[model samples]
Target: MTNQQLLTKPIGIDVNQVADSSSEEATKAESSKPELNSDEGLPLLLKAIIEGFVDGVLILTTNQEWFHANECGRRMCSQISQGKLPINSIPEPIWRVCQSLIDSREWFSDRKRFLEDEIKVNKSVEFRVRVRWLTLDLSRDPYLLVTLEDQHQSTKNSAITDVINYGLSQREQEVWLLKKANFTYEEIAHQLYISINTVKKHLKKIYAKQKQLMQH
Candidate 1:
């Protein structure tokens, strides 16, 4: 994929639209696999979105066959795309990205962890490759969602938790969240029905804990 192409980019699978086709591919490997279909309507939308992506978006089938690929995704489809050039051959950077995932799977066949790589595509472009495995039904192998992005900016979103992570106690966390929500010390004191001094003390300790976390 070109640097300019890595700028743009769903999980559901279609039950009916994909069922017959999935069964056929499932048979290609001489396996009796139950379908891992997403709801009919949702996956159709998903497939459309995935294929419409300018960024690389690929859906690995339960049998590791190519289920869907956008223009950018075709670049790395080589992992199984045979000798069809881009599909048959992956970019060197993306090759390592895929290798990490395959290696992790080989190391711990049962346990799984997400695999990722930030690879230099060119002097002007770096790419971040990410692969996430998904659930599958009986008689099938698990599938993967693969994405590629240019380094200028990351498209992947980091999940934010409602609760702040800390070694702080439950009450301390409560105080911290309140403070984060822009509650004043005196307001928090009234809400918790604690003395203003106690609120200040908790805030002090919370700041200390956060500082400690930052240090580590």
Candidate 2:
């Protein structure tokens, strides 16, 4: 796909809107239970907020136990866990990273520590996992929020696959994929180890090809 087309394509989730709504709901939940600042109350606040996120979300305790899983999270776990309970269904690679974060003192000391990694569910499916430390309430301890996104799902509607199907060059397809992922021009150039001008040149060719295909 052309860089412009990729940029303009809808990705189906408005993250800012979700964040705003979640924050507002959390505020209301907090006000209702002013003294309930433990992990018990924290999940209630998070549940309302995270339900709006497209990603699969899991709230984990300090000991790595699962406190809650959103609907998307539960669905993802069912696919990966092969009938295991959602609480015990964390994939090993993801679990290992979660364990390390839980064990690290830095996670507790640094209030804003964020960890991200990419894991393959199979040869076809891959997910980007993000772990962030959150202090939902000052009266209670912090918790780990794990978010998962199916990387392939995000690009399914974009022109990455179309570029490949249309017999575009490998470099062109790579550029399309990165652009579809919302990479800036400079970021795409850096990732592909090409000059910005080269990236622009690629996009021009891609745009022409896409236009040509559309005409037919």
Best model per lDDT: 2
Top candidate on TM-score is: 2
**Candidates' C-alpha lDDT:** 0.57, 0.66
Error of 1 at 178 (Å): 40
The parts of candidate 2 lying over 4 Å away from their true place are: 1-46, 84-88, 106-108, 160-216
Off by over 4 Å in 1: 1-43, 52-54, 61-65, 75-88, 106-112, 136-139, 153-216
TM-score of each: 0.41, 0.53
Which residue window of length 10 is worst by lDDT in model 2? 1-10
Candidate 1 has an lDDT of 0.57
**Candidate 2 Cα deviation (angstroms), residue 153:** 0.7
| TM-score of model 1 vs. true structure | 0.41
Total backbone clashes of candidate 2, pairs 3 or more residues apart or in separate chains: 0
